[model samples]
Target: MHDAPLMLCAGEALTDMIYQGDERWVSRVGGSVWNVARALAVLGERTAFAGAISRDRFGDALWAASEAVGLDLRLLQRVERSPLLAIVEQGEPPRYFFIGDDSADLHFDPDVLPEYWSRDLRWAHFGGISLAREPLASNLVALAEKLKEQGVAISYDPNYRNLMDERYAPTLRSMAELADVIKVSDDDLRGLFPGVPLDEALRQLRAAAPSAFCLLTRGGQGASLFHGDQRADARAPAVAVVDTVGAGDASVAGLLHSLARHPGRSLQSHLHAALAAGSAACLQSGATPPPPAAMQQLFELLEGDAS
Candidate 1:
């Protein structure tokens, strides 16, 4: 509401039904862009989860979680539609399915978002299953293009899912072309570019967005940042990782927030902040917004290693 800078993470906000054991499952409010928006706001950015949720129990939880993280509610939309959900069968590697048809997410009306929201916007992020769906996906793609033309910085993370097979390659390329920053895990690379060698896929992805600051995260192995002809890599500072749930989201948030906050910082410094934030998220369970104190401690550790 104030004239402070705003960032929009435009995508789905869903209820994650994570299976525990023997028919037990716990519900959590999650989605790629939702997590990014929450992580950014948690890191003190004036952020908005630019999507819609059903006016149901799932929506209720998501609404509260957004507020708890200090997100600007004006950019949030609630509709009288079915709630979107990610039904997860957690395992060594989780398998999941989306359970929403024409849900509230698909009904998000960008036209109704706060007037002049774009005026102070610093960055606009896109990705998640929201980009793999219709009407909504098309609308989001158009929105990203519009914002880019308006000179707003754009960031993207495909957060690849089964839904985004070869059909998503074009969207990937186009969005990457417009991105000022992009985040992709190695796993995401494999999934998004199926049948291609990982290295080759990454090469092609980079070619699509040659000027964008590309953050390539390799889970606990750490991350790499590509800028023009230069590359920066950092080993993830060790942590007793409790859950990697939102680590990628947290890392992307860290990198983008740092880039927005300190555009003059070295790429290595930004990468360290991202790795620190990702590790910080791992210290907690169930995609909790990480504590700033924890992030700083880990960030210092990473900085020490570099020095």
Candidate 2:
């Protein structure tokens, strides 16, 4: 019953082990929702991360990272288990081999969120593997439903990994219907709709989430935000990308930051900032976000373009 969090992120947080061959590996703390939470905190949002964090070394690193960015960690559950790990192969779309069975994040308990939290939560973000798993996914779905009832805005990112194919369609429809904002990448739509064209895929999404602001992130092609008859598109500036690990998460963070700070502004104005944040994240390695100064710089750049 503490002063309710303004923004709460619910989902998995794991380590990505980038195998560089010859027994070389680089590990970084990342998860779709985890990245958004960290990025939002970096962008000066009052955010809370509500997910199970293991007591293992990787978990320690993850917790420290969140704390470093000033994320409220009170809602994080600590457990005695190995954190989830992803063996990744860097490429155009990237490939991931997950090594998580009965992992700590999967054991997160939604009941731990106090009922009063819904009153003050302006926005709740959910996505990644959490919507594809068992008991945890169910917990997140229940939480989203309850938050919707409390009139809290819900933002969702369908960071589709191939592992969720079995239940992806139904889950996507459910989340699409519940979310106030839905962010998905070109890669996500490619997987969800297979041979369907991007425009048609977007149409499908709009039909599914009729009332939500639907965004499509298209890497170098930039991004588009659609809400009813209004539409805003921002083209990404050419930048030497270190790795696109958390670009979409950064985009979500930017969108949330805009919504929280400019509650009365148009989506078009907000999306300009979102595209900037996503592009900035691509310039750096790992799931890092642009600093507050850099974010303002980006917004200025977009304004310059508009003028």
Candidate 3:
């Protein structure tokens, strides 16, 4: 819509209230899909964030961050609803809870997006607790299905949260089957399918979307890819982690960035790039996506070592 190719990330964007000692808490802008959008934009991709944020102070922070990241603000919605907040009420071990019902993110109206946006969209990304969050989740599923019919690619990552209980199973399977690319971490596999072994959970996922490119991230253990019957594995580069807040978001964005920017390259190489970007994200604190230089440096380290 804005001349260059467009990529949309449709999901939640909320404020993260981190405990800062006795009685202080600091707020920061964060949301899984939003993080991916920022990472994609930082990688020079024409990205749009299609989520709704409130007009309040918390929403102001998110709006400013999105604008600073060069996102196409035209597709971003500003609403009068309350902002969603993830409060890390405890510092150590990070015990947190959400604060908001009928928030701005749930008020996102897909019909209001730019007309014919799907025609130019390289891909549309969906996932995060937003998928587990009720009426909004249904809205996104319907949107994704329509976009699929229009021939636009779809990417999904169900960054599982405690909120995703029994009600989330259907959405999980539906999104897995609908996405062109689906990413799930080892932890997600366990959380999403309790009591199911890791391999069994993955098998179930493959059965749901056997043709989709499946990315399996195992944190420090590395990552693997499955497409058809062929599988590829790549080990992650060890880095001093400041915090793993946005690492998975960076990894997924890194994979997409490589695929979009390096057509015809091997999927194995792309996986390595993802690991590098994820490692880069850990070098910094909070939910920030790595700049191109940091990602490229780790990418080179990975590519060079592999070669």
Over 26-100, each residue of candidate 1 has an lDDT whose tens digit, in order, gives: 898899899998999989898877899999899999999999888988878999999998899865676888888
Candidate 3's displacement at residue 116, Å, is 2.2
Tell me the tens digit of each residue's lDDT in model 2 across 73-168. 888888887788988876455777888888998889877655565567889999998888878888899889988898889999988888878567
Candidate 2 vs candidate 3: the TM-score winner is 3
Q: Model 2, residue 300: what's the lDDT?
A: 77
**Model 3 per-residue lDDT tens digits across residues 1-307:** 5463478889999999898888988988999999999999988889988889999998899989998989887878999999999988775655888987889998999888777666777789999988988788999999999989988889999998888899899999899889889999998999999999999999998788888888999977889988788788988888888988999999999988887889687778888888888888999899998878988988888888878
TM-score of each predicted structure versus truth: 0.97, 0.95, 0.96
By TM-score, who's the top model here? 1
lDDT of 3: 0.88
Flag regions of model 3 displaced more than 4 Å: 91-94
Lowest summed lDDT across 10 adjacent residues in model 3 is found at: 1-10
Error of 3 at 168 (Å): 0.5
Candidate 2 accuracy as lDDT: 0.85
Clash totals for all candidate models: 0, 0, 0
- Model 2: residue 298 alpha-carbon error in angstroms: 1.3
